[model samples]
Target: MSGDVVVPAHNGVRRGRPPQTPEQADEVRARIELATAAVFTEHGSRGLSVARIIERAGISRPTFYRYFGNAEQPLHSLLTLSNEGLVGGIRDALARSFEPVQLGIAIIDAYLEWARGHGPMLRPVFAELHDPASPVSGYREEAFDDIRALVRAKFTELGRPLPSPLDLDTALQTCEYVVYRVSAAAHPGSEPDPADVTEARLTMIRSVLVTLGNRADVERALTVPGIFDERV
Candidate 1:
């Protein structure tokens, strides 16, 4: 009977015995958040379900409501957090100037590191990349939009002829496809192998450079001694 009483939660009714202390409540809230992310990782946005989350979290419906209005809140929060982290480093790198090849390597570096760190969560998030309703779907475009604007500003500041805008956007998208492949990897022995990871990085760099009409420079950069060496 003690555990059956209805209690107020943050946004829903808590059906179980409530936390006796603020710390306990916070702890339960964190557990729910983790569970939400786990569910999101297992199922993309389209497959999200409150029932599954509650089952996964081992909490009653009311207890789940105590912290969230719905199942999507927790994962949305996670996506927001992940988006910041994944894009922040690239923003910083983009703020500074780099040679053409250097820029390619820089973006590749940022992307790979972010993927490795977020690998567990990456697969599901990227699966919905083109899903109009998915939060993750537009993130790549938004980041690319920012990059295009920034490159325009930077090039104008240098008094150089503007590269074709279409080319730039297509190039970025081309490279993004590679990242998506790595991130949304579902097959066994996909990205974990160091060789596959290395090859992906090399391809990303080369694709971007070639698309940008830097074919002459690509060979030189690609040949740079140790350019393909995996970063720790």
Candidate 2:
């Protein structure tokens, strides 16, 4: 045995097992995202820094970088997640075959609930999307597509042929934007009662859908089975 006998190296061993797969990496990403959202709420998304996020997440800088290239990546991912939740609700409301009026009401109610639940996330979305400087910044095409598919399904249910005309696109754009605006108004400082705002929103949406075509068909469609069964 030489005086410089080698000792087995245990230098890089982690205290616990590491996450093994991409799914685990995604899970870590999700945890970092949630922690980032909490931190953002306390210190606005724009104010969030990589060090602050890493500190809040209780993760090393390397761990943070593994999931998010920088602070903005997590913030953007969070916004996408938030938007996806809102889009899911829109899809649900559309699935329920309510009258044009009922559909509008359902959409408004669903959206309002989402805004109430995710108030912090909405602020950044609004700021980014509403800013003239940020073209294509806030709008998620995938999210809007989820909503459009739902509307298309309702149209199909009412035996309406899909129009190649831009009319349908215009109508959907109006309806979605109305909900977005109403939700922003309900965001805390607005004078309007959320309930009343929702009602007013639905009324406006109904008017638009009716103007496009088939108001009565919307009503009849709502009366059909599974629309309001509540069991769903």
TM-score list, all predictions: 0.73, 0.63
- How do the residues 73-156 of candidate 2 rate in per-residue lDDT, one tens digit apiece? 887777676677778887777778455556655765676666667655555555555455432254555566676677677778
In terms of TM-score, the best-performing candidate is 1
Report lDDT (CA) for all predictions. Answer: 0.71, 0.65
Tell me the tens digit of each residue's lDDT in model 1 across 1-232.
4577655776886567654698888888888878887777777776778898888889899988988898788877777676676577666666664566676677667767777776566777667778888877776567666667766765576555567978887766676677677655546324466766777888877676676635656667756876545568
Clashes of each: 3, 1
Model 2: worst 10 consecutive residues (lDDT sum): 223-232
Q: What are the runs in model 2 whose C-alpha is more than 4 Å off? A: 1-6, 9-31, 38-48, 98-101, 130-139, 163-196, 211-232
